[model samples]
Target: MSGRTSAASPAWFAAVRPVLAFSYLSLSHLATARDSHALAALAVGMIVLLLLAEPLWHRRPWAIALAAIAGIALWQLKDSAHIHIALLLMPVIFLLLLAWLFGRTLMPGHVPVISKIVRALEGGDSEAMMAELDRYTRGLTTIWTVVFIAMALINLALALIASPGGLLARAGIDSAWSISDSQWSWFANWLNYGLVGAVFAIEFAYRKRRFPGRYKNVADFFRRMAALGPAFWRDLFK
Candidate 1:
């Protein structure tokens, strides 16, 4: 390997990224809300959903898959909740997990991308390092870039086909019934979660681990937050 870090990286980016993304998504949707009541209801529902899903994640394969499918379906339904935040950002989480699980296996043998970027950012690009970065990127382009492009196309197709407006409408909410503001808010949130969930599942399964480090503080925080109860708690009583 080009270089090995004796210690895991700080949780700087991981801690902040999700919050910012979630805020952007929520605010963007709220701006489209026709009534304040709807926005408030959406905020409440979204918080509840986030609390519910956070603990269920646990870096599991099935949870990841369900998250993706649900998030995508919700997006299709035009839901505006933060549930999609988890799903949409699933790719990053998967990368982090992969890096933690198999960091040694996924990183480049020499002059890794991080080092090069840091060096460039700090204005310290030696000729040898540049050549190494070039070599590494060239190899990466040859081996994986095309595959990623193909995967992107596949994801797009899946998203379109699985859209809530398309396949999920078959679930058959009564079209004649006037949807209340709260109901609309709830629907928007569900759609967001479904789309995000789908992305997470897909990325977790397909993407290579490039992020480096063990579980960070924020990940642990969210993991615990998500784990509010047993997965079948709601079903067991029935």
Candidate 2:
């Protein structure tokens, strides 16, 4: 028998599989929080089973459904507090999970996928790219999703309450009375920087290098310390 896979193999597996797994996690978190096995081993086992079964069916609808169900169950089990404390850890887990199951099968590596998307955004119409970017980020985690939703609601409420003319009228009396266009723009930009910085720092520190997984060296240690210098200064001042 030929070892070659069809063109559809990758799209059906790499792209679709992770999404299905995440869907499973969401359902699990919301609906099966009571089960002890919902979070860790059980979730991993479910993913394994889905992976095994997926190839058998040539990545059919049932394969996707099974994977998604498993992912949702596991996500449902994430501890609320741990979720906040370990927000940076969540994407690594998702990336590794995707790589383990579908890395070889996928056409482009993660970095290349991102690079291409960025190029497309800079050169072409941005609407479609923005939509895909939204989907890519949405696959992040339960905590991130909740936080973003809360931010959106807060911003919407702010917009509704402070009519521009009314805000100008009260600006002389109260700091809170002013919600200018510049203020809204500044808030949006600040949020963007914070989120991007957090993700970038995590990726920079932990991603695998060209070499196989190896211990850090003295040089690497010093380099990390150098990177932290700015943060140390800011903290000392505060």
Candidate 3:
């Protein structure tokens, strides 16, 4: 019984880690709209989680100290008007980071990120299947990069247009470029997710048609994607 419990521990940790990490991320986004104190707490929580989960950070006491200091500073400065600006810019920053992740791999000498994921999923498939997977995955990577970039740009545009003291205001442009803050918030917090979900559904449909031989049903595809999460994070951080 002790041996079985010990053997199951690693598998349990592996299964729970991604769920915890994603929950933390989602909480951070939700906390941004609260107050500076909430955001600062979220920041510290993330750093603590990272240190606990990633063995490499265990030896880096200085890094942990610096992060704690930064988090404290953020908490101290929470009442500043700048904190509001940071909250407003959060969606743009997240989208841009995703864009960079996908776009950077598209450069010369780097395997497409989606292809890397697909290869992990395929494991020891036949050469013919691999060749088809490679082509399809590369195309999907390109599509994802474009989508992220577009989302980032749109988020940025909305942020600028909603800012009363931003460039558009200084330029005396009072058209659609001067949208309300609530409207921008609606897009950033709500519609943005809907857009991504819609795109994912559309892309799944396209993939089904484009790679009929390689494509499985949506449920299977998602299951494979879920299985790839652990490997995905390891590759991403490495």
Best by TM-score: 3
Q: Provide the RMSD of all predictions against the true structure, rounded to 1 decimal.
A: 17.9, 20.4, 5.5
Query: What tens digits encode model 2's per-residue C-alpha lDDT throughout 75-194?
Result: 764543222212222233444443333232223434223333333333443677556544543333333334444555554434333333222333433445546533443333244346
Ranking by lDDT: 3, 2, 1
- For TM-score, candidate 1 versus 2, the one ahead is 1
Model 1: residues with Cα > 4 Å off, grouped in runs: 1-16, 22-130, 141-148, 167-238
Candidate order by decreasing TM-score: 3, 1, 2
User: Using Cα atoms with residue i matched to residue i, what is each candidate's TM-score against the true structure?
Assistant: 0.26, 0.25, 0.72
What overall lDDT goes with each candidate model? 0.40, 0.41, 0.67
Q: Residue 200, candidate 3: how far off, in angstroms?
A: 1.5
Residue runs of model 2 more than 4 Å from their true location after superposition: 2-19, 27-32, 38-42, 49-92, 95-113, 120-238
Please estimate how well model 2 matches the true structure, expressed as its whole-model Cα lDDT.
0.41
Q: On residues 1-238, what C-alpha lDDT tens digit does candidate 3 reach at each position? A: 2454223234455655566555545554554444344663554455445545543233346665766676676676655545445545667877888888888888888888888877887778999988988988888888888898899888888777774533354356775647765566567766888999999999878877875755568788878777776547567523
Worst ten-residue run, lDDT, model 2?
81-90
Candidate 3 global lDDT: 0.67
